[model samples]
Target: MRELGAHAAALAARRPGEVRLRRVGTSRQGAPLLLLSVGHGSRQALVVAGPHANEPVGGATALRLAERALADPRLTEGADATWNLLLCLDPDGSRRNETWLTGPYTLGRYFRHFFRPGFLEQPEWLPEGAAGAVLPETRALLDLQDELRPFLQCSLHGVDVGGAFVELTRDLPGLAQRVAHSAARLGIPRELGPFDTLYWPALGPAVYRVPPPDTGDLAAAITEAAVESTWFHPRPHGTVTAIVEAPMWGVDAVEDPTRPADPDALLRPVGHTLRRDTERLAGILARVRPRLRDTPGAGRLLAPVDDYLLVGPGIADSWDPDAHVPGARALPLLDTARLTALRLAGRRLALRTAGLLHQLVTASGRDPDGVLPELDRLIDAWCADYRVGCGAYWIPVARQVEYQARVVLAAFDLAGRPTRPHPPADRPARHATPRPEPVRRD
Candidate 1:
């Protein structure tokens, strides 16, 4: 919370007209969750919430955008000309991710544990009738959205490993081309599509459906349900709603030809790639600023293009590695290894379920052994199924595993069977492994 406050304060101080720290709500821990509003005009409203904890880039990008918007007056100007930009919706999550934020070279580590709705093992996503309820952070946003009712709402997210970029929207015109053009300018490979076609295919059609009239306050209801529902569903009410999932690291330029398996060698050029991409993204935004202001009903004009372009193949080429080495697999192996470690960690947590139940039985005099076993079985099953489903894709594997772990942990906590850490295992010692010296290039 202190960290979030400090960052927010810094943002406000740096960009007075474009940034304001507004208190949205408090977390269960009573920590204040703030919304950083940038830009100051009545022409159009743009809301971007980030760091949902696991995905910090969104927060970083949002802050960067806010700062940029403040610095550049044209961004605030529109055809009829006025715009409102809200930055950073989840401060609690963002603050919790301070470790990664403060680290010097921890993008890889951060990407590995990248947090998402289901992955944090949070209690907020659990069903009210079945288990726990929504988190204060999510709830606050729901309330805020209802009150503000912005013209455009975007949740910034990024995948650590993947060749494709995804822009999720139910229906938005020209949003696809604009986003793709923006991505191209930024140098990030991207596509625009419905949420269903990429990660949440099952929820795609449903998300596209127009809400029934009685659906009072669409965005708020959808936000509430999203935070509370057991499954991922699209909210019919948001005027222009979508999630942009960018790749945290670059992907192999070549896909068809298999390459030698060398994770280190594969990632050596990522830094250069990202630097180029950042510059391109900045340029893209600059170009789009004028078009956004000039277009009448900019939100509607942007929607259709946003949907189709995001998912289409044309946008996919932006992030492709400039040069391809034929016969290389082009796999995001580093991300794969990190994701595997996370899954193992989640599995290790399951091992403690029995111990947790025993502790509960000892302390509360309630034997939940039978129920614990059943729950354990269910959790194991979920994890196994999740692993299988996500195994084919590095991004999905990490995402789904994180989600399953969160759900399992929340369920266990709600059931009053909290677990404790086990003592470290002893192992036979051998000669110490030597650290590799840094490689130098002439």
Candidate 2:
């Protein structure tokens, strides 16, 4: 964060009047939420990076986008949008994940260093807390949304393992095509299977239509909270929120479109493995809860673990081997099994649990001999399985950053094009009622 802050400061120095850097809000842990405002175009844009703490690929993209906007007028003046970039949204969670941010990027190292916040702790979830209070980070984003009333907002995100895909708040066919072409040119495979946004309506191979704001969907059902970030943004502003994701590790199976000859037989093991892993994780947490419950911030760290333990078994029970996927030409059942195993192996939960315990033991001035090793062993087993099952190959960090930046740039065209405007009803009598701007000359 210090490094990013310094970079932003240096950019402002390079262009004194055009670039403006300001503190929008402070994080729960007291990290400054900095926003870099560049260009003076009439339209407004918000590009958020590191919204998901575990996904650091977007951090690099934010830096690149800022640098690009400073160097090229086309992205800002040409598109007629003053680009406002939030370099990192969840600094507290991002700090915990710094261990694996550097090289020697193996699956084992990645899992060992992984740290994702619980749904409640996340900045993107709505006010699910008592008294309707929100995390400072969430408040920062909401305040910005209200102040800017942007025409475009893009949230940068990435998956641990899979090909590239995108989710859009509104359908923009041109932007989707451009994003897909950029990934293809860079040799990044498009995700062709049911992955994170399985319930989302597909616009193409890698493009998905996100659920409307405040609308009940699979995500809202899971957390019992409306998404407060992209989904909560004012639709009256004609905001097109693009949630873009790239893969850290490229697995060829995720790109496979072959339907299995006997889908049920192929998917049977997935259910069995899910159940087995769920039980294993539950048992691990049960034994460690007594020792770690009182540790500082342990509740915050274990929230996701608790939710996983509660939901994992039920999902396993409901996983039907006989059911057919939406797209008949989706990933083969074997591919589904591989991704599901890696995701449900309790790898993320084990890492977060062990990390918290390590902190507690260290703060007490004692060695970590208690529950850390047990969780470490589970992570090791998960790493071995991932290599064999997923045919794991680490995509270069440069490529992931580039792919995210290209996708956002592609969406510039969508932002530039005028949408049907819906002005607020409470406008003052003296001011002229706003109407959609006529298409501006290049």
Candidate 3:
């Protein structure tokens, strides 16, 4: 963590005018991830950060943006000057994943082992108290937002599977068009709508409540309340809020399956798209920058609600495995099937192979001492098979499998027993019972 801070400080020193670093707060390990502020002080500013642990690109990009902002005089000189940038919100998670960043493993293998989700185990959504109640990182950010009262705030993130870029916003002016144009410029396919098609069935799609659109006192009240309690409740200010998502490693276009498979290939385009969008963002701020300077109170505030409403009764009705595209069904099922198979195989090899050796020794009754050598061989062979067949297959099936394993393991310990079913029911019952034979239509 100190290494990261030193690196950031070095970058800031290289370009002093546009870049400046301040210690926002410490992590669980007491490591500080500095916030890099670019541009001059303005009533309206843009805030962005990355690396939320599992997805490190956001942090990397935030650092890159800080570097570029420092180098470019135009960004900070004129009316378009001054925005607060929060770089690397979760340095703890970032440091946790340092092995993958500096390790010798392939990217696929690294993703499989190092991906860490949010507070609740979801990939992108931050948990209710992630890090702790009023995490220093979150606290510093809210303080800055309140003090600076920036007109726009964006949380940058990336997805591992989907190939499309999405901007999550309740109601922001020209947001959809801006995101779409930026994606097109960067050559990334995009979707501008609800946040529904983001999860798989096994993981369960959770509905998020967005604040109603309004303005003034109510908005300020909601924002203040949120900061005071760290609980999300909708407000009616209609302040411009947006979240940008770039697919980390997947197909280039959601509509086209023939695009490049390498994740690095997508980085340049994603960066370019973000760069273009940032420039447009600059334009938007420039237009409204003077107003904020002239009349700070005139600006509106927007707050995001933090509760996920589980659509329990409507799960089947609203569920669409292929909601994002036509005829593109079964991908999630296929991935889940592969994950379930690998998990079962690994567990079976571990337990069954051990039992087989024990049974052989007991039945022979010719002395259990002689069975030790054969047991070692059996264990080695079983492990080799498990690695090749299960671990290997799990690498490409999205990072969620690893997350699910962690969750299941934790549940097991909490319950004082292995929560995962032993031997995994011999391949998930082969076709899900045929949906009750269609209720005998005749």
Predicted model with the maximum lDDT: 2
TM-score of 2: 0.83
Tell me the deviation in Å of residue 319 in model 3.
Answer: 3.7
lDDT of 1: 0.38
Better of 1 and 2 by lDDT: 2
Best-to-worst lDDT order: 2, 3, 1
Task: Count the clashes in each prediction.
Answer: 38, 0, 5
Question: What's every prediction's RMSD, in angstroms?
Answer: 22.1, 9.6, 22.5
lDDT of 3 by residue, 1-442 (tens): 4554676788778768657888766655576657777777453444455535655555555555455556666445543556456666677666656766664534333432343432332212223433343456566555555555544555555543333333323333222333333334343333211123323111111111233323323323222112222112111222234444554333222333232344333323323332333343234333333333333222211001010111111221122222243433332222232232223322332333233333333333444234535444544554454445333221122222222222212211222222232222112222221122111111
* lDDT per residue (tens digit) for residues 234-306 in model 1: 2433334454555543332311123337544433333333334334323433334343544443442233223
Candidate 1 — which residues are off by over 4 angstroms?
1-7, 14-19, 43-46, 77-87, 104-108, 111-133, 191-196, 199-238, 253-442
The superposed Cα distance between candidate 1 and the true structure at residue 334, in angstroms, equals: 24
Candidate 2 runs further than 4 Å off: 127-133, 213-229, 322-371, 418-442
Best of the candidates, TM-score: 2
Q: Give all candidates' CA lDDT scores.
A: 0.38, 0.68, 0.38
